[model samples]
Target: MAYKITDECISCGACEADCPVGAISAGDDKYVIDADTCIDCGACAGTCPVGAPVEA
Candidate 1:
């Protein structure tokens, strides 16, 4: 499974920079994770201030 960003995301761009695979991007409401590109490294999860990133 890959890492996903939930609706709890504050669109702070913190998780996007943390993704080693560059799987995260800005969405209309929140930061989205490209599941195909995600490496499940959990790097984004740790950097999210609102705890928006989770395992999918």
Candidate 2:
């Protein structure tokens, strides 16, 4: 499964830059993951300060 950014995301851009597959991007209120592009590597989750990235 791909990782999804929760409402807890603070729009810090940490996850976006850390995503190895370039699946994460800035959204209206938070970061969002491109399910089709995500590789499930957990890089975003590992780098997120608020633990916003979670398995979907």
Cα RMSD to the true fold for all candidates = 0.6, 0.5
Candidate 1's residue-wise lDDT over 1-56, tens digit each? 99888889899999988788899999889899999999899999899899999998
Q: Candidate 2 regions off by >4 Å?
A: none
Report backbone clashes per prediction.
0, 0
Predicted structure with the largest TM-score when compared to the true one? 2
lDDT of 1: 0.90
Error of 2 at 40 (Å): 0.2
Put down candidate 2 lDDT per residue, 1-56, tens digits, no spaces: 99899999999999999888888888898889999999999999899899999999
What does candidate 2 score on TM?
0.96
Worst 10 residues of 1 by lDDT: 3-12
| Predictions in order: lDDT | 0.90, 0.92
Residue 20 local lDDT, model 2: 80
